[model samples]
Target: MSTFEDLAELHIAAEKLLMVPAADEWLLRGSDRRLDEAKFRKVMVDLLSAVNRSVGITGFVELVRQVEATADPVTGKVSPAAGAVVLLALEQRIDDSVLEERISPIMVVLSRAALRSMNAERELIGLEPLAVLQKAVIPNEEILFREMFPELAVSVDGYMVTAVGSHAQAITPVLVNAANPASPMAIGPLQRQLRSQVADLTVKRATMIARTETARVYGETAKETQRTNGITRSRLATAGDPCPICMEEAARGFLSIDELKPIPLHPNCRCDWIPDVENWLPPMPEVVQA
Candidate 1:
């Protein structure tokens, strides 16, 4: 199973890969004399599309592997039927609905920031700031993942999966200097802020994907253990020194598999549950009478 640290590292790597181009574009557009509403919109759309594509391709592949590794052994044998079922369940659980719920608002904030940054750039160039327009269309999660990783396959009995990661977070609120008109707005500050926000968003999306996949894998693993090995309970384990809340929760001891919930008492949670299997062998029979 991929450790939480491993997952985080993957997110960081992928974010960096995508951020290079994003930063370049933001800088290029900031200096353009012809920058207008239409051009600004185009840049926002292009950035958003790149984010979706990078996360879908990089995050999804890692997530699928983590889930698959937990549910099935890596014995170098392919099981298309089983793999298909697993893929379907994961797709259903972590589909567009899930992505939209977590990422749509962030994207909105990003689009707005992008527009604001453009305006700041224009102001620095002795031009009036353009009014912000309606938000750009957020990329579709289904299309992103499907285009990147359309199918789940196995080769030589091992699942084929790719790995990637990077880091980012939410945008800080934009603070304007409304006290003076024609005061040169600093494009540098705005660009830096946008860059950080984009990086933050990348990390957030990747963490979310990992959390969902881990939960699904835990649930399925528990079910399988119970069915095949008569395991009925699971114990919670923390990856390192757990937080006060997780430590308190862990003190509760083992619980029935049905009663147990996946750990990550909060975001960036590094806890997991270990199953306890009961001995299923029958007792020896008493000696027969002569």
Candidate 2:
């Protein structure tokens, strides 16, 4: 049985193993060359592969075990079996929409950061940033997932294809506004910007994924327990951080099961939802005998 802290550490480790390296590799490639569509596609593919390999069904299963082992703070009871089912359902949701729900946004953010780094490089060199005429088309998710997790891929090649052309379209204006193509550009600032963006986005995306998945699994587990055991209320438990908002919310105490919501009060929120099975039923009103 793992503690909540143990579960957190596992998530952090997975992020470092998968997310950080992928982001760093992308930034490295982006910094090494001028914006080229071919290279960018290659890097994106590599990133997707890395992400897929880093955390698989096995990793998620371990997470489910950890979450189940940890006792609900309010009730001090662990519901491993129920939690397992909920986690599996969450996995299904991830499989159905991971590309659209998770990867695409991450790619867009990475692309934006790359463009910004290029512009910053141009500015440092006294040259205006180049206006982006067209954006790299984001590759098909099925294709990306095929080599790694073929079973998880919905189709081999043909499926609903969505391109990240809009992400490129949106960022071009920002680059055009900041760039001065007429002047000479330096390489140092651009390199620095790429590194910084990579580090920042890596942590941001990883934390978002971890926290979001955790919240989903926990919420589903709580709901399952409610349905199974007739439990009707839960409470929010924090990592005991000094964050004022979390503390204030924690002070508010237990809420009805229907009223309870997922954690992540903000980005990187480490709070957990603890089902209060023991005290779930509300007190009966006394009869008025006049």
Compared with the true structure, what per-residue lDDT tens digits does model 1 show for residues 71-169?
A: 323232224553444345434433343333333333333333333443443343234554332222344422332222222101100110111112111
Candidate 2 overall lDDT versus native: 0.40
Each model's RMSD to truth, in Å?
A: 26.6, 26.5
What's the TM-score of each model vs. the native?
A: 0.33, 0.33
- Give the lowest summed-lDDT range of ten residues in model 2: 156-165
- Per-residue lDDT of model 2, residues 201-247, tens digit only: 33444333234433343345335535445556667777646388778
Off by over 4 Å in 1: 1-182, 186-189, 200-209, 212-217, 224-229, 262-268, 277-290
Residue 286 C-alpha lDDT in model 1? 67
* Alpha-carbon shift of residue 26 in model 1 (angstroms): 39
Off by over 4 Å in 2: 1-45, 48-183, 186-196, 204-217, 230-232, 240-245, 262-268, 277-290
